[model samples]
Target: MAFEIVRQECMKNPEGRSRPCNPEEICEVLENNQGSDAIQGISLDLSQVGDLQLSADVFRKMPNLMFLKFYSVGVKRSCSVKLPSGLESFSNSLSHLKILWNGVKNFGNLREINLAESKQLTALPDFSAAQNLKHVDLCGNIKSLKSENQLKSLAKLIVVGCYGLKEFSFSSDKITYLDLRPTSVEILDFSTGCMEKLQYLVLNCSRLKYLPINDICCMRRLQSLVLYDIGGLIDKSKLHSLFDALLSLKVIHLDGAFKLTDLPNNTKHLSRLRCLCVSNCKSLQSLSELPPSIEKLGAYECSSLRTLQLTSHFEPSSLADKKLLGPTLCYSVSYLRNLQRLTLKGCEQLYELPEFMDSLSSLSSLDLSESNVESLPASIKHLSNLKQNFLAGLKKTSFSARIAAIPRNC
Candidate 1:
């Protein structure tokens, strides 16, 4: 019986392919390369072979190829079948081309292009003439892009989830880093002040509703801004119109802005604003003034934040060791005298807590886990540096303290 079917396909497939490698054995590996007239680099991952065609010259016997990767993984619709185009004759020693999750869609002489998880790439071609392109990382569903004079020596443009891109007018002034996600862009111009070495911006668009930031030509060398989950489409009077020249914004991450109540009552002068991360912003309530150079203030899970304007003339060494306040049902913090890690974990409608809390004095660590905050503020016995999980939420909640002033290794 054909010698037991060739010994069960030669000892159960000794790591050998069953068939799919016949493009004349890919031109006998660029003419065995020793003579070296061609063949620089080439990777052809058939993605486990499917119907197999790939012929447009199969890279024309590799005319001094530079680096080419042709792979195939999955998810490709829209009439499909569009690979093997001849790659414009390797467009001058093709630089570096990476196409993942699917077949070749020609991109010769690239500098750096990574397309990961591509459901079905839509655009990107016409690199003007490939003037030493820079870098472009795409997540999937490209939609189309070929302008900005074909990416004028692009720097780094990352586009994620481009749902057939509604718009994108590039202006790469040697672009720094501009990340755009979930694009169906309603409006995005950055006010036309032009990409002046843009300092890191992640516009996690929730159908972006314009981003002019009170135009006078904005984005003044932005320091770091991540508008994560921008659902309410930017309110707060357009985020106070980006506080004048955007004073090199330090780190402002507005997470899940569901309809912010405030922030930008002129941040009192952002002397390099340190770090203000507002998480789960469930319609923020109050926090009207802040910025003695704000040294780390994370408002996490903000269920309608109640207080924390933090002032005592600000600047208490800028919150010293940092990590100040973030689970607000805010009972008040006597002007946060240099806080050092306060979490109020899960503030379950935080009951009553501000018995001056040992006057903070550089609080060591207090989390009040799953808070309904029963009690424990006999000034926390003068908290000398409160550690032991800050009496571990005074053990089993409702602890009003005075178990002999909590000691004996509590």
Candidate 2:
């Protein structure tokens, strides 16, 4: 009766033009009652459904309904569901199922399934028929599986935040992107041959002392790699080797790695690399050089850095040397004709301006705040197109005031 009403209303109103009576007006009482033997191939999950019992007739009526899901609806006690033996009639058709927050047990499936986060539940039935299952998430449960072979059919798996999981086993050929963060996992055995196609890898805050270099080297197509805040990753030998192995890498971000003192040895060889960010490394003293293909360089909050080298791939003669030219360290920064903006904040060692400062024909704005600079370069007066100039909180103000007082075109 319920299915007929639902189907008729759904089909009659092609564009949903008719309105049915509101659910508030409908009755909640279960009309039919039957014994448990009538139910077949039935699966159902419900949460906080207080004092609810499945009469055998209602169970048998849903012989074809194989999948069910239920969550908490404010019930004080768990709902105890009884499985009728009639399920054997439709066992082959009942493949996938889930029972969350419902006291369900002795359920069987032939293919895919999940039973996660039902604290009050215990006991798991053997699922030998579940051969076609590809993904499974059974987190937050303490019940131990009878054997690890149950997971052999799964390809992609998620067991995060599962406290009681001491150990398990499965095939790795079809699985990729396994997340073991914030766990007690000491070592991951990825010697399985299926890791070749893995691309994006993330190991943030894993507390790992080291990683499997061979496994990472096998992923030839790896594009993005992130390894931040790992405790024992002080030496760059392994990291350099890993970087050397990834010939197709495009982006590498390693932030807050306090123990990293030296840069990767062959880092400049990432020929196709575009973006590199190494911020908040307290021990880094200076940058030797960078790849010319790099488009963005984020080296913020790196206190130990003293020298910076900027180069281009066009030609050596095409580059200009502005080192120690004067009290301020400004040089062919204008040659970075492609440079859209420039900032020199807290550059304490700088004292003089580079001769190229006056010829920055492309610079729209300049910032020289919180520096030891005493005066603006006389060449600045020559930049007739100057729009915005930032020289706040300098060591001396008289020099800036005199420059501001000077007449333009002087």
Quote model 1's TM-score.
Answer: 0.29
Candidate 2, residue 298: CA error in Å? 1.5
**Top TM-score prediction, candidate number:** 2
lDDT of 2 by residue, 218-286 (tens): 777777676655555644777688878897777777766777766775776777766676656666655
Predicted structure 1: lDDT: 0.57
Q: Candidate 2 lDDT (Cα, whole model)?
A: 0.47
- Location of the lowest summed lDDT over 10 successive residues in candidate 1: 12-21
lDDT score, residue 146, model 1?
Answer: 38
Total backbone collisions for each predicted model: 2, 12
User: Can you write out model 1's per-residue Cα lDDT over 35-148, one digit (the tens) per residue?
Assistant: 132344544444443334343334444334445454656735222223343222222223333332243333444466555344355555555665546776675555544364
TM-score for predicted model 2 compared with the true structure: 0.48
Clashing pairs in 1: 95-109, 147-150
Write down the lDDT of every candidate, Cα atoms only.
Answer: 0.57, 0.47
